[model samples]
Target: MSLRFADGDFQSAWKELDEPQLDGGWELFTETMGVQIHRLYDEETGLYEYKVFGVLAACTPELCADVYMDLAYRKQWDGYVKELHEKDFDGQKAIYWEVKYPFPLSNRDYVYMRERQDLDMDGRKIWVILAKSSTVTPCMEKSGVLRVKDYKQSVALESDGGCGTKVFMNYFDNPGGMIPPWLVNWAAKSGVPGFLTDMQKACKGYANYCQKK
Candidate 1:
């Protein structure tokens, strides 16, 4: 598909979060470190889609966007990343990521296309990063690794008044295996918060890393 993301995609997500119906619509999962996690269940896939809102204290929108797009820097902070790189498949640029899983479960890999847009909404700068799985890529599957065929993620970043960023993320993916639904839900509920924590730490040291380069 297309690498670009429409503004409505993020705006609609924000609207849902703004007027939350926690009873049936977006259920509250957890909150930690200025982050709130909400989940919506899909009847067809029996999987949960996540909407996350957080503030990266003391971080600028530029820095947060840079850190999100920097695959090299991700390897240093994200321990679960087994492999990550960008490649061109018949002139179409895409990213390949292999993530490590716990024991007894196979690792997961994703081939996805991503795009970033710097938007000016009423004179306010908002950085949006959108990514989704691409089936057109000719990348071969690795043995013992499960390729995640369905995945999509979008993140919106904006300034939170003084030297901080407000982040909103909408993510969904299907592991495509015999994995239990409860296990998947549990992983997301726990893993998402941990990721945001790691991201904050990564942002803090990003300037230093750039200086050394």
Candidate 2:
């Protein structure tokens, strides 16, 4: 898809996410494979907003950005995805995604508009992708699955001064309905790290996946 994001959007998002907020209510949620996950509680929604800081070793910022925006390739690497595809609403484009949940729990889905931008800050390069929940035509809610109406995710990637890409992410969403505290905790502590680990592996294989095309 063509980028709909402005240069300012990339700059502002990168400015906010490039640094970790260690103070305030943010606390260490989990750390694995050199990735640090921190979360802060939001009183208004009773949900936690997460901040992830890490590096994809040996991967360039451009390659990581490409891997992120490649939905077709994402299906091959991300096992949690049940259904994911891009839909166009008139002239606007959005994505519909349904994720698999553990048995006995209803699956969760999201429809959101997303855009990515690559910017050159003097000599340094940065890539940012932002997504937010949106209502689009013909993308109706599915039966038996809960729709996440309040979701936002932003990620920033920059060269790690070498061949690796420095990664930063901020994410939050309410899946609706009542969720067990243990399940939420598990997702934050274990799920986030596991997703990042999978992403790193996906980045490593992205180049090979493209060569066949």
Candidate 3:
């Protein structure tokens, strides 16, 4: 993978993601595993973008951001990912990811640039990590996977009270193939909760891993 990112690029993008366009279009979807999920349809895109927020006890915002941004630690937590790794890195980090989909839809893959930044709001700190599909010159689509080029993911973490991390997430993507609306909705509801719940578990596991090291 090849990427080009200059100084402050990640910060600019992170700041841009601070707003998710959910103003009045969002509608509640479900509350599961301590995450409150929502979705809103975008007529121009003919797709639904999802949002989720929750808080994890015994976790710090920095810990949550670290676990989310660290690619090496992702395999320990993310269940939907089949293959993930960095293809190239410099100031720009480009990676390839193959997502496992319950068949018979072809599994999807993406080449994305990962960006992360830290910001202070008032007196508290906020961490943001974002990923957007990109064209990497050195990477070619695998034969068996459908290339996903319209994916955007953002994860924002901040301290809640003392020892809790509040999470806010947004994901929007087009699978690049025809799929039923029901299945899409099902994935939207289930996927967000699963990711957050898994992150909660990862934070606990990471603490023990760090202490051992």
What are the Cα lDDT values of the candidates? 0.85, 0.85, 0.76
TM-score of every prediction relative to native = 0.91, 0.91, 0.83
Worst 10 residues of 3 by lDDT: 9-18
User: Residue 142 CA error for candidate 3 (Å)?
Assistant: 0.9
Better of 1 and 3 by TM-score: 1
Q: List the residue pairs that clash in candidate 1.
A: none
> What is the Cα-based lDDT of residue 208 in candidate 1?
94
Report the lDDT tens digits of candidate 2 across residue range 122-158.
8777899998888654477899999998888889999
lDDT of 1 by residue, 1-213 (tens): 446557677665444334543566788888877788989989989888888888888889888999999999999999999999999988889999999988888999999988887777678888888889999887999999999999999888888889888888889999887887667867777789888888889999998998998
| Candidate 1 wrongly placed segments (more than 4 Å) | 1-4, 10-24
Ranked by TM-score, the better of candidates 2 and 3 is: 2
| Model 1, residue 134: C-alpha shift (Å) | 0.5
Could you tell me which residue pairs clash in candidate 3? none
